[model samples]
Target: MLKPGGILLLTTHGDITRQNLLPDEQQKFDAGELVVRGNVKEGHRMYTAYHPVKYMNTLFDHKVTVLKHKAGTRQSWGLEQDLWLLQKGNS
Candidate 1:
């Protein structure tokens, strides 16, 4: 939990992840839930969660003040990411 006035930095998958989703996984992505996939390596899995800017703003409404929100590209990972900086409210 964050104390009042504390700032939080968050990162999550962006729309690019949705574009790369497998045909079967598209439905799940459309439902606004995180998607998990088993890795080729044994006993390992990957998790992805995407959040639109609008949704993120609404989510923090009355909770935190959004200081910044941006979309970033990770070429090495072939994925786009959302970055958010939020500060806790005094209340």
Candidate 2:
């Protein structure tokens, strides 16, 4: 577990990826759910886990202070991801 006041930074598939999700996956994502495709290799482009903003908020809400949330441009071979900067807190 992270120490209190510790910082955590990470990125996740976002807008650009969302545009390519299947219809059902898109529906679930729009409903604030984490969409994970587990059939392929973990780090492969086809096996990504799309993280929506609403879902992420509920996932880390009250546990960490959101320092920054930035949606990157097309950087991963025309695929973009979102970056999050958070600080652990006493919740």
Q: In terms of lDDT, which candidate is strongest? A: 2
Q: By TM-score, how accurate is candidate 2?
A: 0.83
Candidate 2 weakest lDDT stretch, 10 residues: 39-48
For each candidate in turn, the TM-score is 0.67, 0.83
lDDT (Cα, tens digit) per residue for candidate 2, span 11-31: 988766788789999999999
Residue-level error in angstroms, candidate 2, position 7? 0.4
Candidate 1 runs further than 4 Å off? 23-43, 74-77
- Residue 86 in candidate 2, Cα distance off native in Å: 0.4
Candidate 1, poorest ten consecutive residues by summed lDDT = 46-55
Clashing pairs in 2: none
lDDT over C-alpha atoms for residue 48 of model 1: 46
Candidate RMSDs in order:
3.1, 3.2
Candidate 1 per-residue C-alpha lDDT over 1-91 given as tens digits, one digit per residue, 9 for 90 to 100: 9999999998876556677677767676666545565564577765545564555666789999989877877687676577889999888
